[model samples]
Target: MLAVIQSSIREYPLKPQHLLPLALATVLIGCAPSPDEELNATLPQLSLKELLPQAVANEYCNPKLDSDLLYGIGYQLYNDDKPEQARSCLIMAAPTHDRALCYLASIAEQDSSKDSAERDRQAFGYMAYSAVKNDSCAEFGMFQNFTYGMRGQTPDIDLGLRWLERSARHGDADAQQTLVRLHSNKGNLPLAYSWAKVLDDQAQIDALKQRMNPQQLSEGEQGFEQLSKIVTSKDAVRKEAREENIAVYSANIHMEYPETFKGLSVAERHALMEQAVATVSARPEFSTRGQFYAYVIIAQQAQLKQTGVDVLQNPQIVELLSDTELEVSEAVKKADVILGQAAL
Candidate 1:
């Protein structure tokens, strides 16, 4: 009945004499059959799928579908254990989608069965490159590669530091947290405290306190105070410090000083020890971006412990070790010895 009416409405002849009655009838009939009546109609009778395009065309202009919607659908498909279909959707969707590009990069770099570690590394490099082209968020993965030497990367500390700084300045909390760790490890307590202050959550602060000792936190606060004073002062030295020392002071310890603790001065060694302690404490507190915390801290501390004892006959470091604390693996011990001798 509605289709017939609609068809008559479309085909209704109009002449000068009938114009007024036609207009009146059209107004009384309204645009389509009643919506409620349509709801009571059977699926087989309505054939909604066939009519949907025409219905939409009648109601509005071309649809304003967003790239994000497609990406979301693609992500849903991916999470539904449909990788190939998800990949196809994402491929079609990514041309205008930055998040899709980032996801593609992650997927390419993450699919272990698709490639060897070396191949993945190369693939990640390309993805990182693509990500950077899109926006600042892409730097996150690039920094990851620098932190861990992959595919003969040889650990480019400078690149890692630069990328982290770039990402942090762009309001990335993960990058900010990383900078805090990096600065804290480098004994740049001022920077670490500054980063920590940005978190602005009481629970988070308490959790951080649980990870780091009061003494360390106090020292960091003092460092921040001192730095604040320096920046506030009009002194030439302050300018010089900002211009020159900030880079050295804020640099990541692990990347900048990758060497095992062999030739470090007593002061440097003590500072590093404090950093190691803080690092160990902070590791378990963060689970989201802190995935590698325990591994990195353990490896670094073990290396430092082994080399410090092997090189300077420093009973302090040796005394710091317990029988069960040191790794007794022959290869590790041999590497420690080599690092110790290299320092001398």
Candidate 2:
């Protein structure tokens, strides 16, 4: 054991001063072990839930460990599917509210049962509302609003647009594109033009100009052609599935933020993206065709950026179409064929 000795350095000569050092020495020797070593030695005896709070208390009040540790613990709980526990861990870490809100939204979306869905929806709504207050990337808030009917508690296009616009203002490219699509479908040419202008590609802008009225576009025929190509394109399916999975998983991962990976640097972002793709790729529920659709959506987004229209006609888009585009179309064809066979 490490120990210290309390001896008087000054010559005493029977003086009263010598007694002062002697008295204090006895008291100092009694309590010498550092608090941390003692805690670490005893920690194994406690339950994980108990130990988690203890770790949080140490990290929060002791000022020894980095704050990122808080997020790490919260992420562990989240991945374990213990959202309530994860929430507490994150709260103690005091991570961003937006991350917490995203977690709440994910939990709601994952539940299929009606009663559970309602409870999850309410919980998600409260957090998403809080999240949207801080960041527009929290447009996941609009998704929640659309799905659950909060505020006035009825689905309203006006309210949806208000939220989407709020997200768009925050520089979300997705929201900007979504607005263009919605306006185009509604035959609001002026609104579509306004939103489409925000895109980086000039070609896409011109294509938006060529957009026929909703009535003129054959939903079934055009959609069928697109679907047929998706299934046949291997590269397209891989990219699409990977991206879609990443988006969904990233959204789920976002739910655990601040407490799970709050200060994540760019390197960490790429690692998590890779992990999310792997997780989605392994899921049997996500068929190859489904994966193809996911890629088609991505290719379409790329096309829309480069050409300004959802329907791609550019040479580059055409080249990508035969490659990724064909994969997506094939996937769609397979789905249609499967459905037809099932009906028979």
Candidate 3:
């Protein structure tokens, strides 16, 4: 019945006489719908997939222009596990929406096949374009690709640091946190504390403030409040990702393959560790992301324990054994020497 009325409405004549007859018929027959009702009734409660194009037509209308509606649809679709469809909305919005471009780049990176350098290049290009437009999320991504070399590139610490700083200035909490960790690691307590104050727990903030002079502490607090506005804004997709970093980043990173070298003899354990590291390091980009975290933290920790050394007392042992980027072969050799001496 709805379809028949819709067909009649679509095919209705354009003349005033025709509309007059329709109006009279609508008034005379109580069972019949007005033209507006016919059209509205045709619009059934369709799923997002069915409604998206119609919404695009209504809101976007032009193929060349970026649409906020399209950007939103793409973001939701991508989150909903529909990348193939999300690509459509995101690509349309990429002309103006940096977040959309970043998502497109990430999707390409995620969907790229083995030996697909062109695809990788395209993905990086998208990130570069988005980053140049001051997309904090894209800036952070580029920093990761260069710093960790986990996206088929060599690690360029200098370039990565520059981008990282840019990302932080743009109010990316991920970049801010990374900068804080890096500074603390390098013993640049002032710079670390300054940045950490902008992105830290109350305890960490208090500790950092204690390390600073009154003037520096005041400056740090002022800067923290200013950047905190950008960092905490819910509108930016990058901010959402930054909030998630606290819960998911460290927990999500794990060795691609198992480090099943435990319970084996020292030599056997050493060989297993070396093999795993070599295999992962040989790959330009990999699940391990250029880090041998599990081997050092878990497998090598066991060896250190067997030597009966207090891991807490020997800060040197902790420092030497805690490199994520250390080569597997080098790590095994170093561990044997250090743990062996500690046993004596």
Structural similarity to truth (TM-score) of each candidate: 0.39, 0.37, 0.45
Residue pairs clashing, model 1: none
Best by TM-score: 3
Q: For all candidates, what are the clash counts?
A: 0, 27, 0
lDDT of 1 by residue, 1-344 (tens): 00011111121121222222232243346745432123123112322132112212111111232343345455655556655555555555555554454555555555666556654654454445444542335555555555455433556655555555545443455666665655555544445665566533355446556656667788656543533332222354334333222222212232223353346553654465545444434635323212222223334545555543322233433332322334434334544554465457
**Highest lDDT against the true fold, candidate:** 3
lDDT by residue for model 3 (1-344), tens:
00011111111112222232343345346555543344323223332232122223322123632254456556656777877667777776666566766777767767746356755766666776667666778778767766667456677765566566667766777677776666655545555666776665577777776677887667566555544544444346444553332112221221122233335554544454455455445644334422444333434455446653344345544455456567655655675566667668
User: Which structure is stronger by TM-score: 2 or 3?
Assistant: 3
Compared to the true structure, candidate 2 yields what TM-score?
0.37
The residue ranges of model 3 lying beyond 4 angstroms of the native Cα positions read 1-66, 112-114, 210-344
lDDT of 2 by residue, 219-253 (tens): 32342243233212335435644543443444343
Q: Write the number of the candidate with greater TM-score, choosing between 1 and 2.
A: 1
Q: What overall lDDT goes with each candidate model?
A: 0.43, 0.43, 0.53
Candidate 3 residue-wise lDDT at 32: 58
